[model samples]
Target: MASDIIIVGQGICGSLLSWSLLQKGISVKVYDIDADHSATAAASGIINPITGKRFVKSWMVDELFPAADKTYSEISQAIGVHFYEKLPIYKLLESVKEQNDLSARATETGYEQYFTNTDVQYLDKGKVKNEFGSFVINGGGKMDTQLFINSYRTFLKNKGILIEEPFTYEQALVSKSKVIFCNGYKAAQTGFFRDLTWQIVKGEYLLVRIKDFYADRIISGDTTISPTSEKDIYYAGATYQWHYETEAPTEQYKNEIIESLNKMLHVPFEVVYHGAGIRPSAKYRRPFIGFHPEYKHVGIFNGMGTKGISLSPYFAEHFAEHIVNGKELLPEVDVKNILIKS
Candidate 1:
């Protein structure tokens, strides 16, 4: 069946795009090959306003945060799932230089609104050798991606808009008006995007049942500890590697996370679940969203990286506006401008 849009890979990007387009009365058919390690499935969905060693605000946080909050809230109400939670991120500062750098950046960048200077007391301070740190970031939260995906999947199934199998490349038919590639990483093998630099990083996370370290906030260092309602279970992880034998959790990664967590808190926990997925990260780190250089009808809205939860909503809305209203694309993020040069 010919639809207004045929989306490949029902990960966070595809799912959110379908939701956005459908809200505008556009018809979208989604083809998905389920993978346990798909980024959406493995992501902790933390949307931080400030990131990196420099502690600068993320790209377009002021604009993206409001849109993301509204979008997720609307989806939660529509799907009857509690998927958004605003949480305090406790960033560990291990040195005086790091603290000074963060302080200077906050003042120079006018990002002081997002952060404050605070001291954190670690339960297991002896586990690792460190000193004082600060927690100044504001407007950060977590999205329950698993719950959101399950609810949306059910919604799609009920509407008869979801295909559960891998999309066959042989079945794709391109023309002057449109081209459909409905497969996930499988699309990488297709001739259309082979020349594009696509870097896939495999990551792994562990679901642990630790009872002693009970907090409503998220803790980040070498690894992050995200709180869950169960009181005993927390989502901790993940390790990133560009070269790996496969997209599976390794014992080495599992041990690394456990060791990291042990340093954060004084508690014993059992590993309940382990998951891994590959992120479609680009060298430029901006999302790719435009038609192929030669094929105008062939467009893409991928490359969300680790920030998919926060980036996808705004970009999806932007893409929808471009498709439905003939709006001028923003040059800073326009895929055409990035891929094609004058």
Candidate 2:
């Protein structure tokens, strides 16, 4: 089949980029192996603006958050499904050092937009362990990524642009147009882009039903408790394993998540689901964009890491424009390096 673009993998990146191109009236043929346990399927899709021990704002949160909201909302309307929400994240403080550090940032002039004074108190005292207190960031939320991706997949299938199967680089017949790899961790093993710094990691998460322990907003402490469309059901996770044996979920990590959940909650909960996937993290910790220097028609849109929710939508539009209009990419994210070659 002839197309303007050929996309591999229907993860978050491929879904968004293809949607962007379709919006511009461009043609796309997406190839996938129907990997039921892909990263995007297991992701909590939490778009947290505040992160780390210091609670610093994420890189390009101002830009990425808005773009994500706009893209997800618009596509949701098109797909007849609501996938994104604007809810605050209540970060449970662990120590006095963290409390002090947060206080400084909360008092700073530029921080008020995301953080507020009322967000600094012992907010969830009766609900969760808030001895040190919890701070809230207003401009953060979660996306039902699996639902969105699934819906988008159906949409593509309906349009006759989706191939629900594996695609090998050796067997690619339609190679005239650009072929962008959005294949997540598997992209590193493709043998073509092996020179790119791929620091993939395994992430495990659980979905549980906590009785009467409902907090409308997301809770981030020992782990993240993200609310779903259902009542009292939250997506809880995740454990980062740098060196791991298999991609499948383990009983040991499931126990670890339960332990962390116990640390945050006083009530009982039942584990409904346990799943694991790999993140395509880069050594430089930025997304990999632009075409391959050797194979100019072959490009990549991977390395979204743990921030795929916040990163993919914006970069999808950016990279889509770069292809459709010959525009330049964000210099820091563009993968052209003379310093190191492999």
Predicted structure with the largest TM-score when compared to the true one: 2
Which candidate gets the maximum lDDT versus the true structure? 2
Give the range where candidate 1 is weakest over 10 consecutive residues by summed lDDT: 175-184
132 Cα displacement, candidate 1 (Å): 1.2
Task: Report the C-alpha lDDT of model 1 over 1-342, residue by residue, as the tens digit.
Answer: 355577777888888888888999988788786834468878888989888877777888889988898889898888888888988787777777877776677566457656654334443453333366445456788887777777788888888989887654344444322434423445455645544566777788999987666456777777888876566788997777888997778988888888887776655678999888777776677777766677566667777777889998998888888877888777756667766752
Q: Record all residue pairs in model 1 with backbone atoms less than 3 Å apart, i.e. clashing.
A: 37-277, 114-138, 115-136, 116-136
Instruction: Give Cα distance to truth, residue 225, candidate 1, Å.
Output: 0.8
Off by over 4 Å in 1: 1-3, 106-109, 116-130, 174-184, 338-342
lDDT of 2 by residue, 1-342 (tens): 346698988999899899888888899999988646678988998898878877788999889988998998898898898888888888888888888888888877767878865446665466688788887788888888778778888899899999987877765433877788888898787645667888988999999998776557888889899898878789999889999998899999999999998898877889998989999988878999888777677888889999998999999999989988989998777765511354
Candidate 2 whole-model C-alpha lDDT, 0 to 1: 0.84
